[model samples]
Target: MKLQPSAVGIVVADMAASLAFYRSLGLAVPDEPAPHVEVPFGALRLLLDTEETVASFDPSFTPPTGEGRVGLALECDSPADVDTAYERLVGEGYRGHLAPFDAVWGQRYASVLDPDGVGVDLFAASS
Candidate 1:
């Protein structure tokens, strides 16, 4: 069996706010506005949808409770990239959850929260 991961869906309380927040992080927004938007990132696309839209597909679907913390993990090319990305996120009005720092494991990483309170981690390999 061949399986490939195409997209990851995130439920947001406010579509526009979430879209704007992701766009500021360099993710491309769809040309048209809808309840959902697909953002292309390298070989993968992230599907961003409103909570209502997601619930429509699965009535039993419930968004993770408690601030929707810990959403996505994105890897960067270098430790410097982590710092740069974190800076950009902060500039775009994202709340900085954790400042960029070198981990004991030797990876540089940082965390930020999107408009919907989803945590995104930026990490890069250290040499």
Candidate 2:
């Protein structure tokens, strides 16, 4: 059998904070409390699990640090939207990783870190 890529799993320390971050970015996540939550991320599913949940299954599970963590890029409607999203998130006390700027890639890009320090990028076509 062949393997299919379906979801991206992130072990978050704060469920509410993580869910709020995504909801702010226009995702439709429910306002419920649970150790595990699944979000419909476009064609793929974004799976969220608390640290305790993972530890229950694997005793040796420990959260990763610094670089090489899961990073996601969200596409916006326009370059201006990227800036708006970046500002809105930062204004709401989210950690801004990279300010909005026009990249050489022909897209306006910005980045913010979730409560767990996961980097989430925002981008849109430069007009």
Candidate 3:
């Protein structure tokens, strides 16, 4: 048997809010909403499902109690884009984890919490 990572699924309580955040990042997400949405990204996919949608399929399913279990790092066109994108999301009312800054690891990095409180990192190579 062989296994390869494919899609990253995020269970969101509010699909509308989730879509807005990803769209701001330049993802080609459709305007029409649904309980589950999959945005194609090259060979990979970003999947979003509502909490109610998951619970309907699995009776024992329950949302995590707190934060920091899963995180996603996204690349930007440039360091300035990282700052712009971060501010855009925060301005749109999403929770900003860390204000965009030049990290010691040599990248411009920032974080914003999705509607479900999942960490979605925005970064770019420091220039």
lDDT top scorer? 2
Query: In candidate 1, which residue ranges exceed 4 Å CA deviation?
Result: 68-70
lDDT of each: 0.83, 0.92, 0.88
- TM-score of candidate 1 against the unseen true structure: 0.82
Per-candidate TM vs. native?
Answer: 0.82, 0.95, 0.91
Model 1 lDDT per residue over 11-123, tens place: 78888888877777667885455898889967888888888898898989887666645478888889999999999889877899999999999999899898877888899
Model 2 ranges with Cα > 4 A deviation? none
Worst 10 residues of 2 by lDDT: 62-71
Clashes of each: 0, 0, 0
- Each prediction's RMSD over C-alphas, in Å, is 2.2, 1.1, 1.3
- Worst lDDT 10-window in candidate 3: 63-72
Candidate 3 local accuracy as lDDT? 0.88
CA lDDT, candidate 1, residue 5: 87
lDDT of 2: 0.92
lDDT of 2 by residue, 36-123 (tens): 9999999999999998999999999987767348899999999999999999999999999999999998999999998888999999
The per-residue C-alpha lDDT of model 3 at residue 90 equals 90
Model with the higher lDDT, candidate 2 or 3:
2
